[model samples]
Target: MTEVTDFFRQGGGLSDTLPSFELRPGQIELVRAIEKSLSQHTHLVAEAGTGIGKTFSYLLPTLQHDKQVVISTATKHLQEQIFFKDLPLVEKALHKKVSACLLKGRGNYFCHYRYEMFLGSAFQLNKTQAKKVSRLQDWVQQTQSGDLSEIAAFVAEDYAFKKKITSTRENCLNSECPYFDDCFVQKVREKAKKSAVVVVNHSLLMADIVLKETGFAEILPETDVVVIDEAHHLPKIATQAFAEQVSSNQLLELGKDTLQVYRREAGDVEGFADCVEALIGAVDDLRDALADARPNGQVQLAKLKQFKRAYQAFQVLMQVFSEFLHALKALAERSSDLQKINERAEITAERIKSVFSPTAADDSHNDDTERQAAQSVAILEWHADYFKACRLPIHLGNRWQNVMQAYADSWLFVSATLSVGQSFDFFIDSLGLPADIATLQVNSPFNYAEQSVIHILPDLPAPNQHDFVPALVDAVLPILQKTKGRAFMLFTSYRNLYEAAELMQNSDFHLFIQGEHPKSQLIDAFMQSDNAVLLGTVSFWEGVDVAGEKLSCVIIDKIPFPSPGDPMIAEQSRYLESTGRSAFAHCYIPKAATLLKQGAGRLIRSNHDTGVLIFGDNRMLTKSYGRQLIEALPPARQVDSDALFTFIEDTL
Candidate 1:
């Protein structure tokens, strides 16, 4: 058997490469824990901190194991970094003959069939698409590496002809699409079948798990082990993946897709237009109702009743849509084509059923009796929170759970931040994993106590205060003055960001807001400007990486908790509150902690990366739970508010 060290040695033979990796005792212990767990087919969550070279620690052992290993990441950036950058480095270092495949959600690739359909339309012949098609065609011919981010620069239009289609599960047509054989999805899946390791994002991994459990084909059937990186995000990702909500956007898309199908089939173009108008109104009404009902305060059983009213109206719209589709199906001579459309609608209707069902079991039964049973369970579970917990059609935690029971030989979840305050319970419970699941935590290679500074602004106004924004700006200005910009002012709300940016009123710094430009453009502006302040919300917290002098300080306005008034949050809180649990702790606090950690995580990405983490929210010092939040974070030196500017000035 080839040794694990062989892959990391200087020139590339397992034995020849083994000599270079002078694995520190801690690193070796982590590898041993992971290897032991893999050998025993136990679940493990290992916290290999920054500078620990966590990626190599896990990759080396997995490569040596020579099993079909799937490394799942939380973000596409990390996924690409692993597949394109880190994996190659490891593979080259060890000189091992292991094939690695990178799989993204299907929407990343041009759906040839969908594109062809769009081509048949008059609107698609516009200058933008023409240029895009030309560029895409040229790139396709020259490109040996089939990654979509390469073409992301060219395809500037709506990624989701259906929804924001970057790479996702919603639009994946699987075997039903006419262009299945030459599909990029299939191509990657084929590669994954042959490769020893497959790198994918968490959503895709969950999608595969969902498909696998339902007896549908999945991407990792040939895989024996799994590694989930960015494990800190697992809980929230799981919760979100498991939760269900019917948004106006989803309903609108369905209506549009239905109209498109109608226009294509029945030459009754005017009727299709009418259907679209009706759908627009119905979706508008639904949105209006939701907007009127705030998510946070005034929580009563009445809110749920109101949501039901909206849901019922939406259901009626779906029924009317079904009737129209049925009429179209009946009038159509092309049974096969019409059947596909009707079946799609049927599946869409069943989405409600899937949301509430015992999703832990395969609900894709064909037999009359089994189908009936599944339907019954779904019906009974509809109003139950347990049913609502599955974040399917978007995420696949429930589905993955089912699939793992049947096929996965072992699963390894590794990250720099997996545990919360030295506990994996937060993640495990959220992922719906058993409490007894094996887990591990590895220390960081960097000396956090000596490096990063965690500054708590105890005197700042409460986050909800009107003066909070100005005070935050005032508090952060000193730090900014010290560094001369190069900071990320992350906020929980867009309104807060706008308010803070407006108040800062500093012309010396290039102020970039989240929605001002394309994220890439905004990031570029931030990177290029000598002293830039990027004000952003949730998305900026975790995935962003700005090393060196580009980012010197991170100012988090407050702990990022989900807005209480969100329809989903309201419903969740009500459900939890009814169950005799403190919705604040179970629903709100954990979420806030997770997000706070993510926001704080932006401060120290690498060992060389140094910055001041300033939490402008006074709750960190004033609240009792604040200590718990601090304990969950990396060991950073605390700085006095008055001394913060001096420290930054010294460092910069």
Candidate 2:
């Protein structure tokens, strides 16, 4: 064992320093692998099961490394945990300190400039939203970092209130702003530049990649090593960052900003009011054209005739905007605000043109770099409440590697659910890592066979059947009764979640639904109440920790597969089929397996956590691929329904 592993042993530095330290062999092995990868300057994809204490495992090695390192996590919760909790523990264990800084996307930080402008702007607010704003007043003054996550009431459901207070890339004035000197984003990034280890979420990391590659000012410092904890989520985040998107919202926002700027600085510019009016009218026309369709999720742009006609009309309007923006360049010398407005207008016009073009995905950009970014095989999808045209990369592996390798020499991707059936092939192939990139799979230190029970309840309707939700709810009612409602009933879709929630409304348990409140508030309520049952969708599958008796059961309504109707998944399936690969094998099953593993993982969080994990779907017993997925998860003891009830009764 390496000295690092020895330090985690029973009488070692960590045990000597921290009273509650437990010797986890998996964590030690993970630490050794991370240390070796960092020292040798290589890449590693590791799957360390739950409760492995991976944050500390990677942090110990990263802290001791001579060169600067950046550690990115998938969630802000993990980002904050590593910076605020794990770093202190590791430093204490080693009896030495290393400087670390937490950096998040700019929107998370409070914007003094935006807040000032927001106060001056005459905005009509409802009592509810205004009450949320009032709640922020005290916390806003108390907070040092100004991260919005600290305020759970972000008005996420109310975009108008949020947009007024928060800063987005398009609206940011940067150094030109009056409050730029005391900017939270600036101060934190400057601190990160000097920090030995920088803590950031994947969104910020992806933003950094896009910024650096696009010849914009980059936020991250040059680092020798990069560790991505919760690496399973990175591929999706990267796909989004690398892809191109243009939306009605973008056009509308541009018009809004143009109108504001024109009134403030460019009133003398002729035809400005007409240009803004036309842009607004065109956006309204597009919205009205699709009013019947109300396109929500992923959709084929070509299939919608109205969408095409509206966009074609917008294309004509773009020419007018082009002329108007070009004219504004003559007035650009009037003020920096005018220059910025012109720049934003030009960029927005280009996005619309590129997205709306007949061969938008195929021959949109002339630059090789842009074309490389717009991968050869991609899905052109239209989505959302208003409208969005997006070109999503079908194969993101090679592109992800290129972006990541450009940033650092040694890279480590550590997550609890990176592997499927003891193999890292799914994850490695997804990220397009070379065959020789180091791979490791360490079992969680928790003895799942004793701590948990996995059950696929007998005789349930297939998820596709119309009666699935009711049947699933009926099957779980007894389990809920037996476990005393201290369970998380996770659903695949909001439809199913709502149906289940409706079915269980009359039950005695306190139900905490996902959308009824902020996610944090719902989880908090669930954890605090003994008879509470939290029903949630994708977000609850992972990143939830409830260690005590309050959460003694987890029930899943279906195999959490990527929806086939989802535009990205459909495109990926077609691309895989064309390449002579089974999309089910390459795309769907692996994605489902990782997600199922995450959901199942919510059950057995710590060594002391004993819970009943029930899968309401019978597919685990009948489907051909079910065994493979089952083997992929921790070795939870499979039990029949009667035995499961008995075990829960005995254990709890």
Candidate 3:
């Protein structure tokens, strides 16, 4: 077989196979390093910058390797890009037949059982939902895989109607479900099992790994190689996967299900209605206790209104419920629903307990990593009408190490934003990888010096100033005029985004504001418009791709810092401070810089792509940490505000 690295040479397989394939030394180096890592059965951490064809560099080697590879990325967009776009190109380049599958989290697939249930409840929906969902009725019959993304001109994300007609861990009935044989999730899982390359998102990948160990319905086949793209996100995503959460919604559903199940299966069972009444009372009491919660709805348990007292009562209530289930379990054998209800009750009670009571430090493992993993914080969050109490892991460094070690022999972590100034120490240490783990950083094959410039918007007020957002809008207005709104105005928070959106609402150029439309539609509108500017928060900082004249500039509102008010970040910062660490240096700077890099990367996506990246945050010039942030991004030329408009004009 031809060597995988040779596929990148000047007259190599890719050159011959792809007319546009250029010989990139950085791509070749990355491929050679990854191939060596896979062949040797060791761990590797690589930072493959944009325009380096990072996808192909990893795909080619993993495809050639004689092992089943599970490629997990941060987003479904990239997963589809790799499987749909990158994979086929590599296969053709190598002229080798390969099998690949794209498996999303279960909810992405349509549920026949729920669809029928939804049809029954269709009368209750308002006219708008009724109209939108009516389309799915016809499509469901003809669709084979049942993946909603396959449906054109339909939005399935973050829609409450979609949730009601999809499957969740709490709602799924598994083999007992009437539609078991036709389960879309099952079909995809079987596909994933047989394919050599299974592509999944980080959340699904983590869930599968954790679920497989517990002997649940497994999602992937035995994994021989695990390649993590956008690996920087794994630590954050892992904490969510490992954390225990119990919500009022869960309790309410349990009560409703128990009542219905009792009426249908065990009418003679005593205490069913009374137990449900107690559950409802418990939920009310818990919610009433939070009546004085901060308006933002994120409160540290200790700061909550009579939280300690309410929590104590809540714990006792769960205990009583658990006791009721224990007694009920005696008659649970009378029906499978009864048995399942009993089990669900027990699990909910345990989660409530675990979320509230984290274990004290255990001396069983003197390792610092273990000690950090053991530290956890409990938080109360209100979402719309319900609240979820979650136990969040302080850090995932050691826990992630164990997961990677136990799951796959060859572990490869790659991302465009894995390093800060050529040092992968922060990324490595945060992930708890050893210092000796093979490390590689290859700059983007695109020439940043020739293709892009960073224009730090001059004389802007400090971000905390009440008038700062206005200043940002004022400073960037002329640039938008020059570029004619063919730009992305990214913000760190909605405050900035809203302020900018309002200011630009009357501009001659079209405005595609985030939250006004789905991210996909907003991006689509921006791409299709002749003169339009897209305004978005942190979400738009990355994962946006527009080439040629449609996107000629990226105007950032501020340094993209993770909000301190964020419950998880707050708890982690508090924990780090308690251990005498500088949370800003250890936690804040690296994360913010990486995010800034991602935003800057939105420009100059291809070698032919060129644009001006304007930073409205004055800190990029005044603060000491600003230098580090600049270095973290591609080495684009730094210009003062005066010259930036001219640069934009020339580039466009």
Candidate 4:
């Protein structure tokens, strides 16, 4: 064994220093592969199953190398695990000193400027609100770590105030602000600068690369490695970050904030009234045009685009005042007498510019740089982020791509659902990975043939059919009896979740519904309850681990495929079909296979765990694609519906 592996081994040289742990062959192979790949600067896609010890597998090699590495995960919980629990344990095991730091997005930390605004909002309140605000004030004064998530009770009571208080990227003053030295964000980055490993979430990682607003290069330019855990989430995250969004509510907030600044600075000044009037009128005109154009469910873009054209023209009026405010700030910079008024005016003008900058076309597009800048116009027509005539195009896939390229030192994209049938082509294509990347899949460690039972309910109603929910309930009733109420009833839609929860409400079984409680709390309650059935949607299908007797059965309501009418799906389908390809076979079926595998994965959480998966949807048995889906699941016993209950009882 290598020195690093020996350090991590149980009862080895560093046993007294490091946490006791084992290194399996799969994990060792993963580490060796990563070490080899990083040395050659090659890309890798490793499929490490749940029991493969993936965490230590990568960390040991990373710590051994004389390089800086950044690790990112899908959730804050996992980020904390790597930084707080896993990294410390591994470093101790190796008997080496490796600096590490944890960083989150800017909004999590307290902004002195916004906090000041929050303080004003607190005092300008009624009796009950004042008492609550006072408590918050006291807490804010004492908090060493100003994470918003720490303020548990306040989030539930004062959501609006909380939003107002959260610091935004556009509004931060950086070095010019009074709180720059005391800033939590800066402090964390400073720590990251000295550390070899920096742990962050996928969203923040994306913001650093694509948004270019997070200032990642300032710390990461010298870094040699990056690891992205939960690689499956990268594509969707990319699309969201790369895309832009503008809503009516956003414009209203901008106007309100500008109005507040105007009132506070110039005491209902002359130019302020005209600016606010034009802003409100322009927003109203767009809303009216949109309403008249589309008397439908969601606003259609075709009509909104026309409204945006007129809205852009109306936005020019604010530019006149903005220029005047700019002159005032320049004058105030020379004289201290008008500093406060000048500064406030300058801030307000910039706010207005941010609102309209995305839509307004630049006349200075002669050079290559300017042309690139002019081409990327934000389409959002409302709020501080909107332009007049364009909508911000939001692409979630691009956002994910930026993250993988940015902060991660080594990204391990692992999921039981990453492949469709026998191919990883769909997911790989979606991720936009470079050619010559290395890929590996470790077959599930479970003895699927001995432990798992897959039974597909054939000839069932369509998922959207009215009888589907009743039929699904009927199909699951016997399965639940066999397992005696220890089951996860996974659904694809809210309607189905509601129906399932209501149908099983009074069965002397604890019924938990999604959105009724915080997800973690709901899971904890379900695990603690002896006989409980949790009814949930997509998120519950994956990233859930309930081992031992707590989870004995998994009943899928139906196959989850993107709805045809969804705007993104429609656009993608049109694009693909235009290229003369079958979207159903190439796109939809493969996508369903991956999601189905994720749902089925919940059945077998550990080596000691075993359960029956009942896919209530009839398509699995009747369709040719059913074979692929069944084959994708853990190697479970194949049994007819009649024998499933007896099998569950016999296994237990």
Candidate 5:
């Protein structure tokens, strides 16, 4: 194996390639450990702290391992960074050619057939949608990759336009389409099969695991090593993947597509249009029923009787869906397209039926644990104007472990926030990894004592108080003034963010609210302004890096605890109670600690960077769980508000 230590030494392998690269002992150690894990075919969990150059630490070793590897990250942005920026740099530094490919979800690619059909249709669209379609047409003719990210003018705000041009698994013609020879998704798969390193997001990786036996088995190539970055997010994402989800939007889309296919293939079919209309009507009735039952737009299925009309509406919707599938089957001989649509319709109907008519294994035939594993729970969630019924597994750990064991010979889970204090038990237990898995914690080389201060406002009231936002505004105004508006006031909820935004409306400082612009645009605007304050919520907490004087302070409104009312969290809490475990300590505290660490890590991006982190929740000092949160953070000096302001003033 190539020597990781030699690569980090002075005038080493990377020195001639990367002019400004500096040697970091922690990064070198992490690379060496990962290399060993890969060579030994053992599973490893590593926590590489901030400023450790973790991306390169893993990338370099994987490139030198001389085996196929799949690197899964938490987001598409990071996937692109590794494939385009980090991988190229590593290849240049090593003076070797390494085949690599970046693959995203199918929705990210443009379907040539769908684009053609969308253009040929006589559907009416508004001015903005029409303009977007026009732009997409011009780009489609010139682009080679056919990835949606290549279109500069296209934004996700136009969902209708996106749906019209992109193809889903249920709708894609695959080998039957006229443009199948030039299909972008198939081309991507072919490239991935030939590549040594494949960069993908967590969602794709999870999809590959869940759909391994299905037609989607080729989504991921065979690999010897699997490195999952941001591994803390794996358990939740995997749970969702293994769970069954049927949504009103899904039904509506199916109806719309069925109508489109009928029009194109067999427009004269009797009663077909009426069946589609009835299916759509049933979907709307159920959505309305759910809305009336829970005005807040979410309710657990166990407590669903409170919504008198939801059950009846769900039954009616399923009946109409079956009727539509029947009608499609009757027209199967009309065209191969109709036959394909009928097959997809039947699969969707079965999925909906399974969600509504849930069953558990018989107790006499199975053990208690097996019975519990077979149970399912339904959750109704609504966002915007769409509703979904998610049927989730009661237990996901054993299933996730089985999938992991089958997927790779060696596994490396790397993240900055994987451990709680000195223990990896919280993460390992959640993901069902073996107790004996290898572990490593590499602290950042930066000196936290000289670089950062954590400010605690112990006098503030609890976050639930009615005046908490007002008090928070009062507490943060002084810091913003001291720092001259180079701060990120990250709140746990949008209500707090909006209230703070209103408070700062007339201030001299330029305010950049989260929803006012895209995240990248907001960060750019913040960096360009001398005295700007960016107020945001959850997405701003992590994966955001602004190193110099552009961002000097981070103000968190509260320790981000999972909402007690969230259906998944409540379910997990119940499961823990049944197993005789402290859910608060086992589930809630560790989750919050990881998030708090991520938020605090936004400060001190480099050894030269200095900043103040403020917590206005008061729970960080008043609650007993505060100790765990404090222990999870970097070893920055804890100080009162006055001293914190003084330090910021002196440092700037």
Candidate 6:
């Protein structure tokens, strides 16, 4: 507490060093809690609202602490922000040297072996792809980090070209490769091993958890403190990491790799080539079976088994895959490269078999309870593009508790929106934290009531009603006209976004659609354009910060309830129903409330910022569940259309 106070007091640590820094009470309190938690080696759940200066608050204590730390964020942008921007400022303020490194997923870095292979196989690529590879080759020589994001000409949207030059876990060859010492991924990991603080994203953290020794083991070294920023996203990411999936693309790649390895080692053995071709054909057959069966949305594999064609496809795929594995094993005796490929192929086959096979009940071990718990929540799913079997843990608290107990000595979970109705129960239960875990909530210093207004349109139809979109467009048009399009029209779905875009197509305001440009570009264009209206879906709801008059209005289409039809949501609902609980009230509503809070938060970024938050959905006013949603938001004044108009007029 004394350390925190010294840093936060006026004319203290930061104020004397940083010219524009002003100590906020909330930030100081959070930093104190973090310091105490680290000292005691306990877990802390903190809901530090926007403007709490959460990054600096957590970072200062982390740097002051004598032990190694790992700070995981939800986005690469945030990872970079912490490493490049926040860390430097904190180090400067403290006047102490702190070593920090930023590490992204391996695919982000260029692989020399893969680059050479890609160049050798240029004849297989189209002219456009060849040109892109040529440009990448030039950049590879000049780039220091070897990170693909540095190449201005390399558009990651072109997945094929990107994959051609990047190394995947299956093909990396690891220590066997000549470039192992100079490998960009290896170099990053080496840096992370030595750095006092390592910055990574949720995906990389999850990879370390799941892959253990094989993957990110080197990158995630033992650390005294582990801080998870954007902690709300952890549960979902953890569930995904632990889940199993078998896709046609994976099988296709396996077949292609086997062929390449066989050709390099055995010079195209007749029977081996035939087996590889058969394996590829089997993959195509499974895809055709899926297409013919038309699993239009995500269907449980159990349900899909009722469709004979799909069932037959599963059987055929399993048999062919087994045969392919046997062929690879036989070839493995001849070539070490083929042996490694065979081992990988065998692992994939086993995973696919496990998805098809029924789980064996075991009563001997207590650990079986956890396994059964996960199995109970698991769903085998088939979508239009891929097939997957995953566990969507409804309550992550126990799982997270176990993870922390096993791996970390001290843990801090920080997020802008972690509480509902001023209680952390919803977030706590989701993360499986015990009630006694140290909890803190710091409301944003921004004066929301003075800086923004929550304007809910009245008498509009429900989202399911046919006229909803039209009525929404009608209701928002005048507000857009009043504000002159310095607004974000956030929708829950692409359908709504497209419908709104169509209606607003003839408007004088400069319109920016989500998919029309990259998100960063769209934000840049929006900021640059006078009176620009940006129409986007879920991604725009969070991670957007546009202060001042460049953006003054945020219009949300409806309550952002998770789609009830989603496989994960449906399974969770079923699990809740079995236990005689209302999933809608407990799960759906709280999730929507959290999202709504995020959307409304976009309006007032700073104390000086003023804007109107418009919810086109009438449900916030008409629905019984609406009150809970409103309660979770910042305490902004509710205003009618006339008041909204007057407020906008006065502010702008």
- lDDT, candidate 5, equals 0.83
Give lDDT per model, in order: 0.66, 0.79, 0.80, 0.67, 0.83, 0.80
Worst 10 residues of 4 by lDDT: 387-396
Give the clashing pairs for model 5.
Answer: none
Give the least accurate 10-residue stretch of model 3, judged by summed lDDT. 357-366
Name model 3 segments beyond 4 Å from true.
112-141, 152-158, 215-217, 267-271, 274-296, 306-331, 359-374, 574-580
Report the lDDT tens digits of candidate 3 across residue range 1-652.
8888888888887888788889899998999998888888998999988888888888888887767799999998889988898888888887888888999998889999877766664558778777766778778878888998877347555476666678878767789888999999999899888999999999999898778668755778887789999998987888777888888878876776677667777778777678677777777666665553433366655444446655555565556667656666676788887887777877887886676544221123336534433577667777446778787777665666777777888989999989998799888867678778999999888888888888887788899999998888888888888888789988888877898788778878898888988788888878989789888888888888887778888888888777797767887788779879988987899898899899888888788888899887888888899898888888988887667767776767
- Judged by lDDT, which candidate is best? 5
RMSD, every candidate, angstroms: 6.3, 3.5, 4.0, 5.5, 2.8, 3.4
The digit string of per-residue lDDT tens for model 2 on 1-652 reads 2377777899987888778789888888888898888888898999888878888788777766565889999888788888888789888877788888889898778888777766655578668756776887777778888777776445556666666677878778889888888788888899899988899999899889999998768999999988898999888888777766776777777777767777788786677788778777876775655554456444554434445665565456556667666666777678888788788777776765544454332234457545543342323343444766665666765666677678898999989999888778878877777867899998888888888889998788889999988888888888888889999998889999999999889999999999999888898888888788999999999988888788888988888788887766776787778889999998888998888899888887777889988887788889899898788777989998778988988887
Clashes of each: 15, 0, 0, 35, 0, 2
Tens-digit per-residue lDDT, 198-258, candidate 6: 9999989988866663444445777888899999888778877666666676788788878
Question: Which tens-of-lDDT digit does each residue in 11-120 have in candidate 5?
Answer: 87777778878889888889889888888888889999998888888888877768689999999999998989889988887888998999989899998888877777
| Residue 327 displacement in candidate 6 (angstroms) | 1.3
What would the TM-score be for candidate 4 when compared with the true structure? Answer: 0.82
By lDDT, is 3 or 4 better? Answer: 3
Candidate 6, residue 13: how far the Cα is off, in Å: 3.5
* Candidate 4 segments whose C-alpha is farther than 4 A from its true place: 1-23, 121-123, 153-157, 211-221, 271-274, 277-300, 303-412
Models ranked on lDDT = 5, 6, 3, 2, 4, 1
Tens digit of lDDT per residue, candidate 1, span 49-160? 6656678878878776676788988878788899877787777656666787888877566556665655555464568657766776687677654456776655544544
What TM-score, computed on C-alpha atoms, does each candidate reach? 0.82, 0.90, 0.89, 0.82, 0.95, 0.92
